[model samples]
Target: RDLNALGGLAKLMPFTAIFTLIAALSIAGTPPFNGFMSKWMIYQSTFLSGNGLLVFFGVMALFISAATLASFIKFYTTAFGGEPTKLTQNVKEVSSSMLIAKGFLASLCLLLGLIPALILPLLLSPGKALANVDLSGLITT
Candidate 1:
């Protein structure tokens, strides 16, 4: 899609705009979001692996995160930040069913971010059991 063709839908489609913003921020790995939690775990694992290649991967991940943040900023501004273009001016908010689904997912993202400990064990358990390792202690340290 042409970025130039989309602009300023926040007023026209407030719900859609907001959900899109949340999705963008989550994808960008900003703090207090699930994306950041996942990336944090990844960085920690890579750094703690004691392997040169893994450490390098952590650095690359940092760079990629930054790039993702910048790109999303531009996208959100163009699509929902500024004044709506002709193509977007008449667009309506998504259906209630879709909104409910997006809202549920957004809430889960916030819940996972706000209380990551609640989900962390469930995530780490299978890995620990399969590898027969004390990954929890490694993560805490």
Candidate 2:
């Protein structure tokens, strides 16, 4: 999809930054964001599985986080770096509406990261529907 949007992966550095920012916001489990729900599922599942191997998943999450930061740095160092090339010099700041949209999504991402519990009921709906199970009793020890 990014390729389709930017003509190819060669022109994808900017998209990569936005993508990394989104991932970072998500891992934090803030509020009003999908990332919160996703991390919540990871936390809930890891605890419920009651297996030591599940603990390793937490480490994996951290590794993913480091990788996200690295990717974003790559995007910044290249896409917005010093000495803009001919092609990049023509680029201008995105429109206000586009920036506002991005900011709104970014804000939601932060919200989800901050208060995941606020969305627990909505997040758990899928688990409820799947097996007709009541997960209210499951607690991480």
Which candidate leads the pack in TM-score?
A: 1
Kindly give the stretch of ten consecutive residues in candidate 1 with the minimal lDDT sum.
132-141
Question: Per-residue alpha-carbon lDDT of model 2 for 1-141, expressed as tens digits?
Answer: 222122222243454446445645465443445664675567767755778898679668656756765765565445444554555545555666776677777766766556655666675678789989876556321
Q: Model 2 residue 104 lDDT? A: 78
Q: Which stretches of candidate 1 lie over 4 Å from their true place?
A: none
Residue-by-residue lDDT tens digits, candidate 1, 60-113: 999999999999999989878778778987888889999999988888787787
Give Cα-based local distance difference scores for all models.
Answer: 0.86, 0.57
RMSD of 1: 1.7
Q: What does candidate 2 score in Cα RMSD to the true structure?
A: 6.2
